[model samples]
Target: MKFKTAFAAAAALTLATAANAQVGPEVGATVYGPEGNTVGTIEAMQDGVVVVNTGTYTAPVPANAFGEGPEGPIVSVTKDQLNAMMAEQEKQMIAARDAALIENATVLTADGVEIGTVTSIDGDNAIVTLEDGPVSLMRDQFATNETGALIVLATKDQLMAALNGGSVEGGEAMEADAE
Candidate 1:
């Protein structure tokens, strides 16, 4: 019957579409660092390693290097590793583009300090604003969730100085000016 044929055709199309859903590395996926900082974006995949270009560097890493982020999923990679891969001219352009194109990034310090969240990222650095508690920190220093607490990355002296209302030269004053 015509109805039966139409139904079968529709079903086949649906199945085919589902089967064609793209998987594996995709552009705009979040790339992470070993310490959990969003290092860069996925430029490409080669030889089982995901090539991440973090603007400053491009490196090939294991498939597990990436995870999810607010803008998208974050993958993991490192600067040194990326540099080594740069020897091959084929991957240079994409890697650099991927590195430079990253707009959002999870930021942190080298020692795993839970600094305030990064508002944005650019080549070689990011703009981080002070956030207020135990800010969740990834091992790589990018990507964190404050949840219910105010995220902070100040040292004991710094916090005491802040609470006590002190000023550092050049930096903005901590407390609001009295009315």
Candidate 2:
């Protein structure tokens, strides 16, 4: 009984150690850009982007700024090498976005202005049905593109209001869309 207990404990320890050994990108990992420049040391990864310590250049590059490395002394990487690393990261992002699961979401302008909810997206052609009726401030229009993901960024209520030619006011609605 003593031997069996001891064996179980040992087995558990081994399994725990193995699980802990799985490797992931570490804080302070070297980051490179598209042109192989040493961008900085990774500080954090959040919201699908990489934050790095500022050295010669600004940090917090999108996760698309890193790549597999020869794992070495962290601080010695040069600017060009870092750029190369980031280039690799960007390629991966493009590939992943291309293969992203097709689902309905809201669309925003490049400047993050709320546009409309995606009615349907077929390949690069996204049908963004207008949310509000034409607003004087913002144009109600559809966008179509190739090799880009259509992002939806609004709620059904917002869409309905917009379609009815209503405007969002200071924490209230100026005009209500017809029900």
C-alpha RMSD for every candidate: 16.4, 11.5
lDDT by residue (1-179, candidate 1, tens digit) is: 99999999999999987864444457567665555666677788766687777786666667755544445555444545555556554355434433432333433332345444445444533444445422222212222233322222344345336545774334533341211
Error at 125, model 2, angstroms: 4.0
Model 1 has how many clashing residue pairs?
A: 27
- Models 1 onward score TM values of 0.26, 0.29
- Candidate 2: Cα lDDT at 78: 60
lDDT of 1: 0.49
Candidate 1 residue runs with Cα over 4 Å from true position: 1-24, 28-37, 75-179
lDDT of prediction 2: 0.49
* lDDT values, one for every candidate: 0.49, 0.49
